[model samples]
Target: MTTIVVGVLGALGLVSFFHLGLFDLSSLLRAASNLRQFILETFPPQFEILPALMHAIWETIQISFAGTLLGLFLSLPLAFLAARNLFGRWVAGAVRLIVGGIRTVPSILFGVIFVIAFGLGPTAGTWGVALYTVGYLAKLYYEAFEAVDVEVIEAVKSTGCNRLQLFRFVIVPETANTMISQLLFMFEYNIRASTMMGFVGAGGIGYYMVGYVQMLQYQHLLTTLILTFLVVMTIDYLSLRIRSVITVAKN
Candidate 1:
């Protein structure tokens, strides 16, 4: 017991030392100083830009919504195939490989590539975010499927139900809540990613933020920050409400 305790303490001490060295306090202080200066300069926001900001906010919402909707729909079929217990080994392996390939590419890179391919607009941003979302949702969804009760599945199979019937009557209902939860989480992430995609000329509030910062339009930057805060808060609240409703229904 003494040897085990000493080993655990030694491991923890190494971790602490690593954190102290890797996360150097001096470097953090320098970054914080720059951030403070930026915030100070952005005070007294430009309220006049509210109309334009509102328009940009709407575009961001549209991008997130479109991407999330497409990802959610596409994931439904793919999730079943990817679930190891539900499909043949080859089929499941292929689906997982595709998902892994998608995940390996960053969303920002996707945005850049689509921007070049589709030209400068939300089309590029929407598609980029959607592709990323597909991989993200599929991974979580397959896990949810794997977690469902095996007894329920076997019972449905014994009832002479085919694969499609089993999926519809047993799997879908059992995993519906988990799937919806994953989708909502994806939308939350997409909202932030969609905003950042605008920096690559993909059409959202991020485009305006980048422009304002480049021109030293600090007041406008502050306004953009305010709009982002409001939008994020609203989405978070709605997500909570939806999650609660789903939980209640499931219970």
Candidate 2:
């Protein structure tokens, strides 16, 4: 009875909040006609630009892969230093503060800053993506590190293992699978993000996407969207397969 009461209250609260926010169905109903017109303009995708778009797609993939790898490399040490069980609260707290600060800023803002510094190119996009990855991955890595089994650490210490040996033989081995899974997840996320890189003048397929929209070339935009969708779907599929293999191996 208590659970049911709480659920009903929560539902009521959500509805009340939406009402307070001025939620209305009229706008949606009105937009249906606009949506129909927009669809008519977007059909029959322009395939003539396929070659150029393919190159842009490849570049997007490259930027995502490079950024994710760079972030992973940087995150490993940061997370190691931030692990409370390994480094104590003071060290972990300081590192967490830094990671939190990084995470506070959005990746697009980083793209803007890097675009200014690097002057509009995939270089800026890659760095922006890397920094974004570092912010999330470092936090994740340290949490995983701290979750290491206490008994295992103690057993390793009993063998006269040094800090490095303990980490290598116990902590790392335990967390290896998790690290790989996280890396793959981040890579998938970065791909989606890299598509927006062009909005900030950082190069990617998004540059063409922006161009198409500005030029009111919805047909071209539709082509880009389709290609992007296919690419993202393929990456998602591959990541799923990789994660599945890792899960099976771990089991």
Candidate 3:
């Protein structure tokens, strides 16, 4: 544990005994006045823009749902191929490399690229969300695939089943619950990201958010933020409930 702690601190550059340091907490104190001023100006958000805000919220939800589904459709196959136990290292390694490369880039960066191609809308945001989902969920799914009982897989194999039959009967059933759980988690995350994508003209609430900020319409900004917070919390609650139901049904 001492070695692990030392390694962590060293990596954090917390001590010049290990490497150079750049620790600075004083700036936050300096920014306190600005933070206070911003908060004071932004409270009790305006409800005048409720209609527009609702539309934007809907767009964000749709973008997130579509993007997550797109990722799920593609990742399911990739997950199977990337499962080391199923496909061996030769296949898994290549898929991992591709996935790892995608994961290296941020979703916002992907949005930047897709915005240029798809031209300033939810399509770009969806593409960005999809790629990130692929990168993130494929790895998760492959891990889940690896954890499936070997005996069950072999028993299915022994039935003279082809690869498709094996995947259908063995892998899909074993991992369906895990995949659903991950899907809900990813959809929640995608909603947050898709909202941010609007900052880049990729479409949805972010556009309104950035506009409100630029105009110093802090009340409107506050309102938008409040709405976003409510949406997130609601989704989180619903997702928790759904997952609980799934878990109970499984048990």
What's the alpha carbon RMSD for model 1? 3.7
In lDDT terms, how accurate is model 1?
Answer: 0.88
The candidate maximizing lDDT is: 2
Tens digit of per-residue lDDT, candidate 3, span 136-210: 999999999899999998888988988778788888899888889889999998989888889998988998999
> How do the predictions measure up, each by TM-score?
0.85, 0.88, 0.89
Per model, how many backbone clashes are there? Answer: 0, 0, 0
Q: Which pairs clash in the backbone of model 3?
A: none
**Model 1 C-alpha lDDT per residue in residues 1-251, reported as the tens digit of each score:** 99999999999998997887756888889989998988888888879889978989899999999988987888778888998878988999999999989999988888899999999999999998888898889899888888889999898899898888888888888888977877887898899989988999887888998999899999898899898989988998898899889989989
lDDT of 2 by residue, 25-47 (tens): 67667678888988899999988
Q: What is the C-alpha RMSD of each candidate to the true structure, in Å?
A: 3.7, 3.0, 3.3
Cα lDDT, all candidates? 0.88, 0.91, 0.88
Question: What does the lDDT read for residue 80 in candidate 3?
Answer: 83
- Which candidate should be chosen as best, given TM-score against the real structure? 3
Query: Least accurate stretch of 10 residues (summed lDDT) in model 2?
Result: 21-30
